[model samples]
Target: MRAIKFNILLILIILNFSAIAQIKVTSNTFYFGTIINIEKFAGKDYRYSLELKSTETDSLKKIVIQTRQVINKDKMLDANATKDSVKDTLWHQINVSNKINLKAKEMWLYATFEGNGNFFADNLKFEVKTEDGNWKEVPIKNADFEKHDKNPLKGFLTSAKIPDGTTISLQPRTDAVKGKALLIKSTKAAIIWKTNYGSNRRTGKYCNVNGIKIYYEIYGTGEPLLLLHGNGQSIVDFTKQIPTLAKHYQVIAVDSRAQGKSIDNKSNKLSYDIFAADMKVLLDSLHLKKVNILGWSDGGNTALIMAIKYPEYVGKLIVMGANLNPTENAVEKSMLNQLKKDFKMLQLKEDAESMQMARLLLMLSTEPNIKVEDLHKVNSKTLVLAGEKDVIKAEHTKLIASNIPQSELIIFKRETHMIPNENASLFNQTVLDFLNEADVKHP
Candidate 1:
């Protein structure tokens, strides 16, 4: 009986040790270490400082302290760290200071980590500059990371996983700079998160297309692949795809006419034809003759129109959740109804921004009148994709593929309209495979 008890105790100890292991994070994925709402700091000049120590410093590994401050509900300012800021076995202090725009309706502070390595963070400080050039502290709870528990992380709106190879232990550590520090260590594992997609200024540019300025960001070097986001979204929609896609192709992600950083002419009406025309003009300005296109939702509709109106500019095509027409036959009735409700609400406001929003909803409710027979005009190979549970009807997605001569169709089972954001790995790989396939011509 005593021997049996010892074996059971040994098993219990093993299980306990397993539970104490570090949280595993996937490699090449962006993670939000902490998020703090700072709306109260609006219009104030502030300084954010933190101390981090890296046991194994890596060039590819990154940790970013970013702030989201918006003006006119559009303009944004973000602060990022240099790749070399992190050092080995030494506590490094990082600091960022800027005036929080008064016009911003919402503001947030974020700490993000990515790549492979282990690090400890402590002594986070948020301070606002006074009129007399003095820095005053702003109260932030648990900034020292001393609280220890299963959910040891407190005071953060969202908590990120401890990196793959590191463990968050309640036991006091000998190497801690002060008290205990938060450990984020990762070997090579997959943990999904986001990147600074829509606001990357390094590769972003503006082009005059048909009188309106369009914003676009380009990355990598290979066959050009244009990415078009759905309605009410910006280049940020593909935050999950850009890093991976950029590795294999020259990704040209555009902020369609009126959304994201690109502003539209409030006087002009929105339509798929006009959007297609803008795309053609933008490509012409860039001197790109033929390019692969990937469009989601309204973007898909514009791409289809572009293929039909200017077939010469298209090399290959991929459309997800696209519809030939804005009718119940193509889109779900519930979605159309919601759009109608939103349009009605926006009409009541009757302001310039409201009018623009109403116009977008109007397009969603009644636009993209593509004829099914027109698919024959598209000469480039096409790939049609949708989720089984997408707001777009399954039959409509299939109809698009059947009409196009050289087209393929795929339906991700149990997925939704947001597959690009939710199932990025599979969605990106599928898109890459289609783009990478060599086209064979047969006489």
Candidate 2:
């Protein structure tokens, strides 16, 4: 009995030691946009080589290694075999079965010892590249002898650099699919342009508009053009188009209530009408009587409201992606559902009630409602701009054009909801031409 207990204790000690000997990694973090390199080795015998255990899921794919062995005093030893011989030396090529796109969130690397007998790895080191274009060395501290497991060794790597000077091809992450793609691409292109030309202005002066403090930015000098952004986006969303628009007209971009850099009222009494009224207050604060209004997406709706509600304050209206009829398109149902999902995802409870109110207002803006007859009341020269592939159907767009007696419609070919930003050249030219025509006809 005593001998058996002693043997059991000895086995436990051996098992504990063995368990502690397996290779383990402690630190793993990487930047999103960088490259990393890993190295493998075997103990003492420089003759030993390392083999990738599996072709699948290795972090480094398409590897090109210089494998000539170093010999004494400036001499190099080549692999013993030739292409024709049984022991021919050939550069090993392994196509990683799992081709990882650089954008992937994680990756792993594995190493194995290849030699005549069992060998251990001691002084393993690696070179890593960060997204910022820098190289770093990582040293492996401990490894022990064990039968090679069929499973590959793993490491966690990330880009060590920030995404700078890298242009991400914008694609939609939502299933409104075509419309979403157009919006994302246009927004991205606009952002790139804005980054190049606009001042990095972030803050805006806050003023009370009917008991709500609204945020606004003013840039350039000339006839003022009030700029309104889409729903769920801030005034900064116009970073792309502002510089170009500023060149020709004084651009006043504002953050609508409950979005962007603007503050939302807790009273939950907000709607697009309040937003249009807030614009009036902003204009009053600036002491401007009338200005050219350029609105995109939801902002376009606000521009229409402003033109109809306060005609004296709006010189002309250039509305893009504006839907006059809310109930006519199936897209509205999808948009409403997406809005609810987005609100839940963003944890925006305060904006929820306001969003519902805004939706009701949109529904009421069309026929059989009080605002239906008001379409003919718009005396301001209106340019209805729609993208070729906008979420708003072409029939609804035509209805808007026909109803707003003094309005003209321009359908941008191959464009989507973000017409002003996506087709800036065409949009700008169209607006300039319209403004010129309005000036000639009305002046």
Candidate 3:
């Protein structure tokens, strides 16, 4: 009877240990849209940041946190058994220095505990305090124990494997102005010129299209002329040409879906087609029947899509430095090098979608497989123009001209991709001449 009782007690202890060995954490659901502060906290003042907490006292031998991005690795918190403040055999607080910058949005924290010569805390508590005075607490749920693990915050402790329950918190910066000035400045500079474009010039308006707010500006009168800019530029890029074009036509320029002041739609795929659709929506909003389209480089591709997909809406098409294939100029090594160099210098901030669009333009421009036959479907009266010194080769320009039945090809002498801005007078004359000829011939 005595032996049986001892055996039963041992069984009960084993079961209790098993239950405690598993760790659990409680916190809010992870949200992608939640704004995270990225500024470092001011002063050397340390806050009692609770890295992990538990309901029951348990001996903790090790604690760690892990993250993918290495933006602020030195500021993380890590503690070992010797560093913990122990009150009893089971309960303890792992104190960490308050000198860490917790401003990055994407990061994770982890903790590990050992008791009775065995690991117990497969989970740990993670907490963070933002400059906005908001506290967030998260628990590491299931940690991987087989792979090498280290404390993400302190970078001191290493584990062969980590079980779940990793917590990450991003602290906002105290000074919002200093931390985000560059981005703000860039955005401000992009739209500042539009303020002076006169009463007819419409300021940027945010409209919901397919549940996304698209920023757009409209100017001019008479026939609609939608101007799409090249990569890395906004609608303000056309300030030099707008006053000229708006004199004869109602000029509308968009910030695409991600560039300029437009807010990106997470659900929508970023493509030239989406851009064209957004323009279609804009036209629908304005009650315009059809418009003349002009695009440069990436915008040029977008104009092509508008002409091809919504043929009735495109009365005429004007594309400059447009290429049906990117590789056509690759044979000339010097031109290829210059193109790559120029492409690298173009700067667009918070414009990931535009970068993707630029890549597509490069690919399409170099595609040897694309032929004039493929462009036959473009029905709009087209004027394929390029600078004499533009990246596009003479043959490719001719091919584009040949594909569109009513299209004419004109090369500006001593000009490049940025022909309109470089020589505004010459560029204006060419466009005016083409429009005059088209009006007489078609009308």
Measured by lDDT, the strongest candidate is 1
Q: Which stretches of candidate 2 lie over 4 Å from their true place?
A: 1-203, 265-267, 330-333, 340-370, 438-443
Q: For residues 191-217, write the lDDT of model 3, one tens digit per residue.
A: 011233211223557777887777767
| lDDT comparison, 1 vs 3, better candidate | 1
lDDT-based ranking, best first? 1, 3, 2
Scored by Cα lDDT, where does model 1 land?
0.73
Number of clashing residue pairs in every model? Answer: 7, 9, 29
Which ranges of candidate 1 are over 4 A from the true structure?
A: 1-195, 438-443
lDDT (C-alpha) at residue 255 in model 1: 92
Each candidate: RMSD to true structure? 12.5, 22.4, 22.9
Model 1: per-residue Cα lDDT over 1-443, one tens digit each: 22222222222222222322133333543333333455676778977777776666565566766554544222344433333547467778777677877656544554555556666677778788877889888767777778855655565643323444555433344654447777766666454433456666556789987668899889888999999889877786786888899998899999988887889856677987888888898899889968999999999999999999999899899999999998899999988888877787778775676787777878878889999999999988999999999999999999999999999889888888988966787788888888888442211
lDDT of 2 by residue, 1-443 (tens): 22222222222222222212122211211111111222232111121122211112112112111222222111222322112101222222222222223323222222211111111122223334445645444443221112223311113121222123212122222222121110000111111111311123443477787666787777788999998887666665575677777787888888887665566636354456777889998999999978999888778888888888899899988887776545545145665565445544434334454454444333333321225577898888888878778877777777777889788887777787766655576677777778767432211
Which residues of candidate 3, in runs, are more than 4 Å off?
1-202, 265-269, 329-371, 438-443
lDDT of residue 344 for candidate 3:
54
| TM-score of every candidate | 0.62, 0.52, 0.48
Best candidate according to TM-score: 1
